[model samples]
Target: MEGFEIRLTSSKKGKGLFATKKYDQGDVILEEDPLVSCQFAWNAAYRYLACDYCMRQMHYPPETTSIMLLVRILAYIQQSSDPSAAIAKVKQFCHRTENEDAELVHKLLGEQFTHQMNTLREMTSHVVSGDEVQEFLTPEGFCTLMALVGTNGQGIGTSPLAMWVNSVLEITMSDDERQQLDLFIDKLYQYVEEESGSFLNTEGSGLFQLQSSCNHSCAPNAESTFPYGNHRVQLKALKPIMPGEEICISYLDECTLQRSRHSRQKELAQNYLFVCWCERCSSQASEPDCTSEEEMSDEDIDADD
Candidate 1:
């Protein structure tokens, strides 16, 4: 994290990140690790091979991601010895949506998610046995975790070449044992060849504390990326930003930029529970019929994917 500060100000957005000083275009503004990183338990059916820490794709072993995520969560619970603290941290994220049906929508989603968590707990019970994890297995705790992840999670991708190299080095043996390992090596190479081309296929989601506070902007001055190819994300200035500017990142895709103001607002309201009042949205309101090509940019959109 660099050149930014968090403050509770009188701004309509409430708490947000502001520039500490002027930053040039392309300057890295902030870098941070997630408060919690987990595999998309809902997407286990998709069978993507993501990194356990960053949720980026891996090449060698596809089965490790989901199991590793469970292991990490279990380890956190064991080490902290207080599951309530973890739940409290997750509760800090915003889960309110401004949609007309927001309450009903949240209730339905929470119930479904709670059931899923319970099912996951049962499935992993054999491997993860302890009272610490059990404390967080209540219906209420599961719902809280789901709400936090739904509102704040960010998807990350990793490089396949790096994962492949790392996987190869993990297996080693003495000179005499090398002969015995030949068959295993040959099969491993075969698996690598079969899985080689789909390097970027792995994707996972996580929650970042500071990044989550940055509000939405259709024409944002800053953008976020996983520059180190892991869970650590970097927020970079898309253009020169002066001190006191509210750092914003888009919460919708390029396609949203192509839509009219009403349509954009509708999507944002439904998904993020807020109405967009950014510069572009304001301009569009004045020029209802104008389809400005400049409105669209490679802005990162945040939502449950």
Candidate 2:
């Protein structure tokens, strides 16, 4: 963490994280394990939990040890209010425990709770969901969604879970957190391919990691060529960035229109706690004519004349 820095840099709008050192094309940034890696399971006492989309089961064992771990993960996900806050809240509603408390759980799990939580949040948020899946999985769109649930995009929007969760759970965003998230989320649209094209996993891998210093963007300055074996992420320069420039990657797929992407970013910001000022957000503010109706009407008027 010394040679590398996750330092904030100046931007016209606000602040963004950048690399203070010169990072080579395939340099390693940050790597860690997932906090909660339970397989998809249903009717395993961890019931009512399933993949956000597809209704696929998220496997989990029901041994005493596994139950303890699952309880702790549910607590962490609930208390921290990360992107999985909605799902966490639902679990809490169903789980009414007499002896369990947040303080006791943290004491038992120790740093694993914090470390894995942050790392899981980062890896899931930044590395898993984008073109990385296209590099690794077939039936590419499913890979993207799978990678998405594996990250922050999980169990929220675009799922039947939202209807049930929304009815029972209330997730509120503070104004400041919402603003910061707004800037961070708007950029994911520029990097990921939209058609859900196929990604070939040259090697079988489940995990990937990136340097924490890399900034978040919809249109990122760098792209990752993901490797197999836990899907380790390899960074590549997408453009000719100057030395000391902050390298960034999109946390979401790029296969969406600017309006759709921006709207999602706004929602993510309110949910995840960061404002997005990525290049796309910047340029889109100054550019014109993203409206489809306007272009269609102009064509009709021209034909009449």
Candidate 3:
């Protein structure tokens, strides 16, 4: 907040954070701990030594990773396209931004109907008292919470082993000492893998107040990192940025960024509901519109989140 201000974009794309001073590549523009954070059940494995990064990254595992839209989240329970009328049979719930009737979840979490039933029953059962009950606790509340986390929760990747390696490399040491240490590290990992067979630090996601203000761009000038290897995030400049420039981050991952204009546009629209107007997308205006080489899935979005 010191060197940046939240205000409306000149392009009228709603509010965004703009630089109050210049920033060089690799310079930290901002650092923030989450306003509120949560651990997913999968993150329970974080107690293990081999962090989540070491485990083969799962691509598009629908059961654990896909994000469902509020509208579609409701439809799974509503069992029909008329979500508003459908929810009236259960309880009053929040309306959708894109449209009340949209079935966007068909593309994201199409097979989560049973998951919703179980989650709603389990989640609502915990309401100990009416005084403590929040409005977001009905069948619709399940949809609201899923959509909220999907849209806003930022993923946290942490690794203690990586920290040890970085610290060892930072210290001055003889070449022979370095070789010995490298061998020791390799053997240590091998030993751990053999013993644990399967181990990982679960990646958790969180919501950050200030960091969330940074808008999306196909070519983001600044990016978020977790060099300290925890939930805390530091916004670092990817390229030099001058005063008055808007700091942005990509909502998609490295693989997704290389997608066609149409493919990129489709994901952004589905996730964020706005077509990206970044320079990279605009420059490729003439590219043929089609689906991506690999269908964009919740797994891809999860990687970025």
Candidate 4:
């Protein structure tokens, strides 16, 4: 299903979408279709490029076919109607409706799309199967892929895309695999329950699908806790959300300096296409003011001299 449609706001960083209505904690944000509709990307990436332990893909591939394969997977997943796709059938597409920023986006998307194809393909081939990929691509691998693709400390660009891949791979339909995933999910749900009661509420049970949309922040107003059952993600409002707010969530829990946050955001933007211009991002861009005790002491000493 097409997820909630968001509109771009007027911001220096180009596009941002605000929630049109009040979204309670654990309320659904937009649900996105997978950009790559099959498990080939996940299986291939994990089997080859990523770390078996951490599942990180930090390098690129050399073969054009591998790159094209990944690109084709991503291209096929795009709805024929989505404006972003060059698919002629797409009557409606995202445009720089408000800003000249549209032009920058147009260029950026093209480059990023091309880069994704190349890098994903390259990353796939570089992994020496036994070194990075799991023995069976079991449920743990599945969830790790789920987490990796969703939002790790970096971002959630791959999770939605990977869901489409899982759907194609029939990862959920195989009775054995389904049971494994179910157990894992159940375990996660339990973890959330033990940690915080508010994370998984009565109305939010099946909303694990929405976990793919939660972004990360150093000082987030929202938080997600994983309980032991159902591998569920429980969302909680750390601060009160106003009506029509974007319903922010954190990618990280600890306090980080502005530069550190920017570094992570940059990683997300480079790896995923979207630039996060969240509250932390804006603060990070500005230079810090001079207000040190050392500076004050030096001033006093100079005055005495």
TM-score of each: 0.63, 0.37, 0.66, 0.35
lDDT of 2 by residue, 1-305 (tens): 43334444675322334555665555554443433333223324434354322223222222133322333343444455364553433232211122222222333335464453344344433433433222222233222223222222111112232233344334567878766655654443222224222321121112222233355677776765432222234456666555567777765545432344445364335333356666677667654433467455654774584
Supply every candidate's count of residue pairs whose N, Cα or C atoms clash at under 3 angstroms. Answer: 3, 33, 4, 33
Residue-level lDDT tens digits of model 1 in 1-305: 36788886465666778998999999988888977676555345545566666655542223233334444555666677577786455556665433323342354345474455567656666666577676434555444444444456665545555556456546786866766566666676578567654334235656688898888888989888765667788899999999998899887766775677766786676565667888988887876543444333212122333
Candidate 1: lDDT of 38?
65
Report the Cα lDDT for residue 264, model 2. Answer: 37
Question: lDDT (0-100) at residue 56 of candidate 1?
Answer: 59
Which order, best to worst by lDDT?
Answer: 1, 3, 2, 4
Best by lDDT: 1
Question: Which scores better on lDDT, 2 or 4?
Answer: 2
List candidate 4 stretches off by more than 4 Å: 1-5, 40-70, 73-240, 247-259, 265-277, 284-305
Question: 155-263 in candidate 4: lDDT tens per residue?
Answer: 2122322333345456437788877776876676577557544231211111122443444444565655432111234455666556556545654324322335445
**Candidate 4 worst ten-residue window by lDDT:** 200-209
| lDDT (Cα, 0-100) at 31 in candidate 2 | 46
Q: Report lDDT (CA) for all predictions.
A: 0.63, 0.40, 0.61, 0.38
lDDT, model 3, position 156: 59
Q: CA lDDT of 26 in candidate 1? A: 96
Say which prediction, candidate 1 or candidate 4, comes out ahead on lDDT.
1
Candidate 4: residue 167 lDDT (0-100): 58
Between candidates 3 and 4, the lDDT winner: 3
